[model samples]
Target: MAADVKTHLYEWSTTEGSNLPVGSTVVSTNLDDNLRMIQAVVRYLASSGTVASDTTTDIGAVDATFLAVSGTTTITGLGTVSAGVYKFLIFDSALTLTYNATSLRLPGNANITTATGDVALFLSLGSGNWNCLHYLRKSGSPVTAGSFSGLTAAIATNTIANGDYNQNWTWTKTTATKPALFIGETTASSATDAVILELTTAAASTASAAASQSAHFAGICNRRIRRRQGVFGRRLLVVRYAD
Candidate 1:
């Protein structure tokens, strides 16, 4: 008996440097469709979008790279989205993002931008709702100046923004019996990043809660704060831990 190995294959094959002009025949099959699906994905990521102005270009349903013309941009949305479907968004500069669609959520449940040399991937959760999978760093300088603020009772980590940043601070947290560090992930997208309390030391801050209340970090990247046990009142004085 022979084993059946199913592989995604396309109906047509192309050689290197062979250009398939637009409006070419597209004969597809089940297997070929799968391959074309992948091909479409590759095409999306490979294609770049026009320099987008504020709320000018509408986000397409493919991998379209949007080069920031100015500082930030707000693109139109795909009013109707399917669950598990996503788009690959690439940026050339540090630009903010916003959507003119209803219930479309990005990282932090808000309009976030891509850092230089970074790519932001957004996934649709059906019903016109979308969320950012995360921004991948393609090239360029890493993100910096990560500082988290205090939320109602939880630590407001998203305020620090997203990027590959280095920490150079003496960590501090609220007065809790079991205090821990967590890198709150992109809201409802990626998993919550956890920071091990490896070397918690005593703090001498005027707002410090207890002797062992500081969550000092060495040098960490992708610095996004997630408030968990940092009581709103008690404060954590920090400098940068490490890069």
Candidate 2:
């Protein structure tokens, strides 16, 4: 049997001891869902360093990374251990997978190899033990990044590991401002605060929605309800958040 969701109507009222002079039409949903995921979801991140060119080091955690290596044909070693679930992919060519498991372990107790643009998911049970959950790669086929058009903002088609990613980040649309959730620059996960983007822009404030428009989205976007005494009123706004 599946779990049932309970819904309720939300109303804006006085927060803490302060009361707003005006009323608000805002609603919030309390989620009580269950996820059967063995490994916790983590933020996307870049590798600490090139695999083949230099010995790699992956900290244990639930995170993501792209394998980028140039100037070297063979891999040295993935030193240290960052134990956790990881989504490791290949963005460079000729990079082999090497890790020092003195403090960790891999399934089959062996090192893995991947070509350029190959993506693999793994879970580390701490102490250097890791298991490959899923992987995507083809023989002699290096999957390089290219133009993709699924999002409103087109992250221009470009290859990774050429050290030219700063130039390839071209947004297609200018009107829409999407919040950056995570930016995988250096080899740091969100937990380490190595690649987390900052929210510099102030969030826009807007009025709440009425009961009639409450259930419908695009009604009152992430409008913060504040009790202000003035002639000016707030309006509904559409909010967009990216991660």
TM-score of candidate 2 versus the correct structure, residues matched by position: 0.27
Best by TM-score: 1
Query: TM-score, each model?
Result: 0.34, 0.27
Lowest lDDT 10-mer window, candidate 1? 2-11
**TM-score result, candidate 1:** 0.34
| lDDT of model 1, residue 214 | 28
Q: Which stretches of candidate 2 lie over 4 Å from their true place?
A: 1-53, 59-83, 98-113, 140-243
Tens-digit lDDT track of model 1 for 1-243: 111111212212344333232234443334455455666645655465544434533343324534333345554453344466555655656666664344555544455556655676766666666666675666544333334564455565554454556544565746664435554434444435333332233466343233434265533444554434444233333322433
**How many steric clashes between backbone atoms does each model show?**
18, 10
Clashes of 2: 10
